[model samples]
Target chain A: MIKTFTRNDLIRYIYQETTKEENTEIENALIFDEALCDELGDLQLTVNGLGRIERSPSKGSIDKILSYSKYYNMNAVN
Target chain B: MRKYSVSDSQLISLYKNGNEGAFADLVNRHKNKIFTTVYMIVKDQYLAEDLLQETYIKVVNTIKSGRYNEEGKFLPWVTRIAHNLAIDHFRKAKRYPTIVMEDGSNVFNTLEFSEDSIESQKIKEDTHALLRDLIKELPDSQREVLMMRHYMQMSFQEIAEATDVSINTALGRMRYALINLRKKMDKLNIAYDKNLYQK
Candidate 1:
């Protein structure tokens, strides 16, 4: 019997939180279910869009982190 | 020889053994996501930078003191630290209301768009910026679930435990967050063009 996946199930599938069996089931369902496919597509797009908006810290922030690590190491060694 | 990406565990082990370069690699690998996580909560680049520094300092102290037991889960562990620090700062300063402008639009909406940019790139940036603002407009519970799952890459189970909610509740918030974001995007007439998102 085919499984009826909920939106939460699809969310887990997108995030790769589903088990192997569930993954197989969802992939099969996607083949025959247009609405399911569309829902998954919309969710995936929004997640991907959120990922693309990332901003990096300044170089100075990174430098300070590295320097702090080095300083701690030096203090520990002495 | 083909270049192989080093695992976070390997980098952590190296850093623990006095390899600063490995620590630098780890930071460079995960900095953007970590920074973005804090920036989303704090909403100020400079303050996020400060918190990022503090987060790493805590990370360094934990690792150096031989207390960093989160072996394989480096990114999420670091992200939790950043998230907590940002939340502490947010609580102490009460800065939540400042993100809303007098016109009801978010401060992020005021970011300048370049007139001469390529159309697709412009749209992508505009959409992303607007989406970021929309995220801020979400209910705090929904926003927390979205950030914990989407940005911090925490599992819904982990998010449930962290937020003191049921797993189903976490999943429901994520679902609503996505549905609401889609509805808002459509209302604003933003095209959900997959072609525009291609690298």
Candidate 2:
């Protein structure tokens, strides 16, 4: 019997939050369900897009953080 | 020696033992994720930088004082600190409502895409910038869930606990966040094709 999954299940599946049994079942369902596959594809694309949008902090900010760490260390030693 | 082969827990241990280089490595390894998480919340690069620095200072203090007990979870712990600091900044300044500027321009517009001269690279960067703006447009609950799950790498259950909601509700918010993002992307005619973003 093919078990139907909800959008929430798909979300969990894509995030790898689903259990091992659920993973096998979802993989099986994806092979037979075009709509489910499409939904997963769209969700996966959106997640991937989110992953690509990282911004780095300024070098000066990082330097300040590092210096602060050293300063704290020096103070601790004193 | 391969840089970054050192795990976060290992780095934390080394830093606790007075190795400043280990601490620097830890900072460098997770700085982008922490910065982006704070940036998404505060929506200002400068504020994000300040929060990032503050977050690290807190990390140093916590680790140095031996109060940092979240072993093997450095990124998420620092991210939580950055997230809280950003939220606190808005709360203290009463600037929550001003997240969307009056002039309708975002701080991301000022960022220079100087490294990539290629047209495709530029298009990818532009798309990413636009997506960031759309993320800002999302409802606060949805955006919060997205930030926690995507940027902070928190599991849905953790997000639920952090936000004081059920796990299902957290998952639902994430689903709506992605669906709404897709709708906005379609409305703006941004292509979802992976090939288009390839260099």
> Can you give the DockQ of every candidate in the order shown?
0.53, 0.56
**Model 1, A35: alpha-carbon shift in Å?**
1.6
Worst 10 residues of 2 chain B by lDDT: B102-111
| lDDT (Cα, tens digit) per residue for candidate 1, span B139-171 | 899999999888788999999999999998899
lDDT of 1 by residue, A1-78 (tens): 778888889988888899999999999999999999999999888887777667778788999999988899565542
Q: Is the docking of candidate 2 incorrect, acceptable, medium or high quality?
A: medium
Best model number under DockQ: 2
Residue-by-residue lDDT tens digits, candidate 2, B1-199: 1246678888888888899999988888887788888878887777787888888878888888989895446777889888889889988998673454313222333234456566855577667778889999999999999999888989899999989999989999999999999999999999857423343
TM-score of chain B of each: 0.84, 0.85
The residue ranges of model 1 lying beyond 4 angstroms of the native Cα positions read: A73-78, B1-4, B94-97, B100-122, B194-196
Q: Local distance difference test, per candidate?
A: 0.81, 0.82
Tell how far residue A15 is off in model 2, in angstroms. 1.4
